[model samples]
Target: MAGKSKSLKWFGKAVTAKMEQAQILGVNQTMAASAAEAKQNHTWQNRTGTLEGSIDIAEYAKAEADGVHGTWGARDIAYARIHELGGVIKPKRAKALAIPDPKKAGGVILVQSVTIPARPYLRPAADTQYPKLASRIRKAFEKASKKK
Candidate 1:
């Protein structure tokens, strides 16, 4: 009976460890998928290649027995903000820039008001992946639990 109890305790610990590993794996997979989807969306939305290539995943915190934490985004891209949560991009009044006109000879054109419509890609990617992630995590947990 003492031997039986010891074996059971070991099995319990093993199961817990497996669950933690599964959770971390799931988080990593989700972050990768989210980053990929965001990158693809950036292309589909007709964005510059800079923003598309900037999408990436990073582990924000150490994984523990409970779970893992991480972040996926274009952290290095400066224009990520304008694409993610868009805002007006009006030209400075004092700095009214001039551009060479192709239609005329040595003529220049003054900069004018510009508006950028919101083309959110990250949040939408997260929203689309959220529903499927729960099931993926469950599957990962089950797979880990079944492993010896």
Candidate 2:
């Protein structure tokens, strides 16, 4: 019984370390995929060339053990949320804007409202990577467990 308990404790430590490594790999992969997708779709124009470049991964600690956890996403880009989930843009008090009509030369028109559609980049990237995530996690776990 004593020997069995010791082996079990060792197994737990190994598993925890492997899980932490797997979490890091998963987050990095997801962040890269998301950034690529955002750039490919051009959700945000590269005016200063910082929007797409700002995507990154953040590491955290797990609740159950000393294992690591992580999250991959963009930070501090104002339009990131709108492009990801999508929402409505309505003028205050239903105010309208007058702009020169392109079709009619020198003619002006009133624009009532503009609807911005959601061009989901992050979710699609994650979805594309989802099928391989399990395999990745398994590989990370196996590789870590093999180490001393």
Candidate 3:
């Protein structure tokens, strides 16, 4: 029997692009949800609302050789790190740190440094949402595949 020869075309770039699109979509969605959760579920008292307002996607989703990358945090607020991870805060300019005296209505106490306890918001939120990341990516991939 005689058969006609057929040529196979490689579509590595297109396939990779589609996979990356799926990853980006998944990461963006998860990061947004994580940030929202962090803002809503925080245990810290909102004084000026700056911390909550600043909670956002510090880095947008992007496709990389390893995988999709993204980040969410209160990037602008300097104290965000201390609150999230727990740390000692020292005065940057002054000889001592001036912290609010919780006992008094309007008072502050001078100290060499203040130790802040960790009241994690972003990491916990991310942890809660990241469990579904595989599913999210799968769905995104399906969606991307359907697009023209």
Top candidate by lDDT: 3
lDDT of each: 0.73, 0.67, 0.88
What is the C-alpha lDDT profile of model 2 across 63-125, one tens digit per residue? 345544556667788877887787765568757856699999999778876566887767777
TM-score of each: 0.71, 0.63, 0.82
lDDT of 2: 0.67
Error of 1 at 100 (Å): 8.4
> After best superposition, candidate 2 residue 144: deviation in angstroms?
1.6
74 in model 2: Cα distance from truth in Å? Answer: 3.1
Our tally of clashes for model 3 stands at: 0
Candidate 1 vs candidate 3: the lDDT winner is: 3
> What TM-score should be assigned to candidate 1?
0.71
Model 3, C-alpha of 40: deviation from truth (Å): 0.7
lDDT string, candidate 3, 1-148, tens digits: 3697888999789878888888888888899999899999999998999999999998899877788798878978888888999988888889998789999988998899888899999889989998978788899888887888
- For model 2, the superposed segments whose C-alpha errors exceed 4 Å read 1-10, 41-50, 58-68, 97-110
Task: Estimate the lDDT of model 3.
Answer: 0.88
lDDT of 1 by residue, 37-107 (tens): 88776534553587787788855434755467777888787778887787766566656656689999999
> Cα miss at 101, model 2 (Å)?
6.2
Candidate 3: RMSD to truth: 2.6
Question: How would the candidate models be sorted by TM-score, starting from the highest?
Answer: 3, 1, 2
